[model samples]
Target chain A: MDNENRIIITVLGKDKVGIIAGVTAVLAEANANILDISQTVLQEFLTMILVVDLSECKIEFDELCERLNEAGKKIGVQINAQHESVFKYMHRI
Target chain B: MPITIHPDEILETIRMVELENLDIRTITMGISLRDCADSDGKKIADKVYDKITTKARRLVSVGEEIQRELGLPIINKRISVTPVSLIGGLKSEEDFYQVAKSLDKAAKEVGVDFLGGFSALVHKGITPEEENLMAVIPGALADTERVCSSVNVASTKAGINMDAVLTMGKAIKEAARLTQDQDSIACAKLVVFCNVPEDNPFMAGAFHGVGEPDTVINIGVSGPGVVLNAVKKHPDVDFGTLAEIVKKTAFKITRMGELVGRVASRKLNVPFGIVDLSLAPTPAAGDSVAEILEAFGLERCGTHGTTAALALLNDAVKKGGSMASSYVGGLSGAFIPVSEDAGMIRAVEEGALTIEKLEAMTCVCSVGLDMIAVPGDTPEETIAAIIADEMAIGMINNKTTAVRIIPAWGKKAGDHVYFGGLLGSAPVMDLNKYGSKKFVSRGGRIPAPIQALTN
Candidate 1:
């Protein structure tokens, strides 16, 4: 990783197969390294947490959100980036 | 880890708990602006600017950093300075607007979000300078974003000043008119009080009184969310058990309050004031003092046993918070403002609480007659009477009490005044139709009886 930044992306929606694999495949194409991943299936709900290395990625955060937005639509989920600054400010000041 | 409580059950109970529960409402830094007092106006203004900015430049930034470092949400970071009247003396009319403009400029320089020294502690009588400042308040507040103003018209020891009350009633009307677009919200930033404590952490009314040192720090710690969440957790817990829950919660929250307040005061090089443990509520969905009572299963507050229950909670909170923080003063009881609190508004709207009931609650609470809204035509005499009555309660009981009522212009009883945001929207509650002409007229220094002052 040539960069020092990572974004924690969370996706939550109706549980379906291949959601994780599909999202990871998209990240692989972008040359984004998935540093850590966590997924939980509760009842009919699926929640995913992904920390991706963005140092070498040739995309801005907004573009990443845009890419994830399409994946979210295909998987019937809502995808959003947690504003690390607000979280860091609120909890890690 | 050995499993004790089930995670699902924990989430269920936590879900029952309010999310915003246990919030630190405010951290107020009190800086003395008296050093800026001078006959030459510009010199005074420069001193005022230098004193406040030097004393408080990093207050908000430090508080925000502390909040983040501790994962504690400090909702409001405010500065309370020496009463501007004390600086210029309430003598010259020009001093009023000029002093206000100076304060506005100084507060902006320090990056202090709100500077609250545009004050007149005229409990006994309004000095000429104080009166001018009072008259300038509406325009000062309407014009300045970072300036907060307050006037103390009554105190337990001095009794209620009828003239000041009368003037304040008119001032309220004027302030409401000035910020009419904000639904008279400028008044929300103001407080009229009996036995107003010198070291209150809340805004508009917070000012370093003449008696205070060159600089001091006071904290107003609030935890309505904590108590509400604590109460909601136990659906079947009786009042005694409920009191236990609130006490435990109060202890934890107040500890954090005390820690933060002490650290902030020390860092700012100011002496710490009392930690106000008032469960101040917000218009925001989850923060309501009334909802905590509702969770106790009274259907609503102000019913039979309402006073007893609230008194119990008030006492328990005081006990818990007192143990946690060394200094505890101001209106430290659960705040029962009508419009600013979602639950209290609901209770008032449902006829579950009355002004009389609220008065009874204030007997044991930190403040009396707070954030309550009445009608515009509610007679100056009636306003005086209400002030007199609330003052009597505070004076007789020897407690710090305050009244912030917005008599919405052109709005009558049962009409709602929407101030929006943190001020919330006040539902027009009715005041008695009778007159206080005789009582208010007879007011002349109701004398500080032996029972009035304590330490």
Candidate 2:
């Protein structure tokens, strides 16, 4: 996978129904493909990490982030989308 | 399957950024102004302005873009130029002031927070042009915003230049007096140095050296809060284990600096210079070097064993940071500025820290006696003596040291001078009443120490 086009999206907040649905809806609208997802609920809090492919996204990276953030806010969660390289560079070395 | 990164690692990174205040302190673009020199001071000023504006035009935007994309905070985007004194042919003090104005204008136009290198390297002796540049430093810094100045008055090889030291003392006093209404803020933008590093990305000490490339990008990483949290996590660990933990945390923080420097270098098409592995602290709560020291079981920073604790932390940070980056330059250790760290301020306020103790800590710390405020009535000769002491430390130990002391006009010990923001506020600490007039008045070079002969 092209590292530059891969983004790790983290959604964290209180556990609620449709949290994933709301977040994926924004990504779907932007044509972003969810490559992998691992989610868990511990102590009534939801922690979701998604590896998304933005190579085919139809919007700018910033716009995608904003849309995801807005969707997360509406769904009562906080979303952060960061380049995968930041993670790789910090952890792998 | 997508590249599998443990969820724990992802969460840890998030925690460092969100909860621990781990962030890149600065992305400084160093632009050499050797080519900007001209026989005419005005022409030189124009050339310097045009070059800086053109070179660093995209610095702030690129920094912002990277910040958003990485979801990390890059606190400052700054520029460092070659020392203005090196750009010869500027005769009068007014000519140097015009050049300083141009540098300030360029910094504003390019949107950088501060531009350094209105400096002179008089480690051994002062030149005619360099002297003129030093003379104008007070007025230049007071008249302009975002123009930082530094004067290197001593080095291990050339020993201490008492003449330059005394000159800088007067200049600092004048800078304070000129901006007294603003809490003597102009003095905060000036630094006096011994064994100064040319590629330091932090200000008010950063400057492009003659040996550097035409332009380059250097990164200064800051994560004292992150280190403090790591220390807090393992309260029962032994000293060896504690050092290991701090080193590991420093490695991770410096890795972020390396990545940011590489990304910004590629985006800006400038050569990657270095990643300064300094655990720079801010005035923000929980983000302090003193807090880290206190976490090491010290009752407070500047108490007994404080210097030893700082030595361990500073060494561990360097060890971890050097392994994480290809190039580690600048003052790559912990910065313990009084006003800039909340815990340091608290320590001073509670009488746990003193200027004398800070001077001792500087022997092991990265820089020396930074951002300390003294009484307004403190004599210039005393200031020169303090700087001389710091220079002597740097000379004998072969490390970089600096003095950024502010003698706040009309403010006495226990009074506060508030510059706000990153400059922070400092309580004026009492100084030794004894005068150094007799010692500093007999001014001459202190001569190279035995350590200087490395052959």
Candidate 3:
């Protein structure tokens, strides 16, 4: 009901090609803009942290997760999308 | 700009990351029910036990489920009911054993591991019924399993009850003798407390007092593993950085405690008590508060470096946990129970640690002088000294604290007492045998210090 426009998606698992491009392309097609990005590879584990603006996206948070889930299956990674508020509460407060 | 980090800073940070694996071995729930007015003492104990089992039945399972589902492991699920002495007063004098039996049965039925309440608090004086219950305590614990007990013989608020304290000192010896076949393991289940808090989520001290509501749920969250992992992550961080890292990580771990405690209370239908953010270390590898100290630049715990590092970690954990939850109470800091911690057990075995060093650490942490193993031949006066030193810290600091020492009967110094499971094991250490005359002869109250009155 509140600010449903913000979202954060974390992708983990394998490290390969076009992950950033593929996810960002989906967001770009859905009209979402990337606000912040941080990624690291710790001991062969690929971890990506991202914050995105999803107001203009073609689908909602659930729909975006669904689409990302599909792409995740193809890329051999797990992509999870949570609302920005959940992410903020988890990391900030 | 590049952050400039010193070599000492880097080493300190590494030590801290390594420390996070230790956790508060347990958060025991004390439920007080002095108001149980059943005409039959049996029914009263039954009702009280039911209220506890009903309130806490799902505690262990829920904690285990959360450990797997949420990845936040709860080290123990325990309940402390009202001190039996209060309910089976002189009026209800005839029904003490039945109450103990009913209490133990109910605890086992509900899957609760440690049920506390078979206790009497004679800080200033003892009544006939209180005396009777005190006599029963030695036998109650020896005959039954799972029921842990405690007595508050000293308190700064009430001053020390030397008469009752003397009685308990003798009682502990009798308990040790009674359970000598079990290596005096039953004595290990009893605690001598000073200024005992009503809502302690630890055992043998957790008895639901009469003052508590019908049913309430309290959770103790352990994050030594998290802290250890964080310390390990920053093999290059400094002492200050390590402190900051441990604090932040403790903050997150306490938050997990806050979340799970609230959720468990809601699910089980009980009010939530404090989220004790104690880094209760365990016997498992990497789960030692001593290791945390080692990670903080001390080669091992019990050295000069150990005290300051433990103080830093303890204070930071309290500050962070208090910020996370408003109702935080009990001994809400790190714990250094010797028998339960692997690194601590190793430290004791290695001769790098001593009882005095552990005492110093207790001055700044949650509980004082916990789970230490001493020689079988260690005299009772020394036990009083061991307790007196701990009680002094609590009385002087005006905090709740206790001492649970196991004098492994027949097991001399350097021998090991292995109870296994969460009780872990402890190496029986050398102790002073000369102080019996001085300690036991000072039979009067250890008067409250002038500093205690200022507050």
Candidate maximizing TM-score: 2
Off by more than 4 A, model 2: B452-455
TM-score of each: 0.78, 0.99, 0.79
Q: Write the per-residue lDDT of candidate 1 for residues B1-455, one digit (tens) a residue.
A: 12122334223222222265556678887788766767676577667777777878788888876664344568787778887888753356666787778788987887766788788888788776787888888888878777888777766667767788777766777877888776676777777777777777777668877787777667776667767777887999776787888887777667667777766776776788778887788887768878877778778867777777778888888877787777787667777777878888888888888898998888877677777778766776777677777877777777777777777767776778886667778787887777877777675666665763445
Model 3: per-residue Cα lDDT over B380-425, one tens digit each: 6667767777777788787777888887878889888877787888
Ranking by DockQ: 2, 3, 1
Candidate 3: list runs displaced more than 4 Å. A1-90, B1-30, B57-69, B88-94, B232-240, B441-444, B452-455
TM-score of chain B of each: 0.89, 0.99, 0.88
Worst 10 residues of 2 chain B by lDDT: B446-455
| Each model's DockQ score | 0.06, 0.79, 0.09
lDDT of 3: 0.71
> In model 1, which regions exceed 4 Å deviation?
A1-93, B1-18, B88-90, B266-271, B450-455
Predicted structure 2: clash tally = 0
Q: Which order, best to worst by TM-score?
A: 2, 3, 1
Report the Cα lDDT for residue B274, model 3. 76
lDDT per model vs. reference:
0.72, 0.94, 0.71
Q: Distance (Å) between predicted and true CA of B199, model 3?
A: 0.9
List model 2 lDDT by residue over B211-231, tens digit each.
Answer: 999999999999999999999
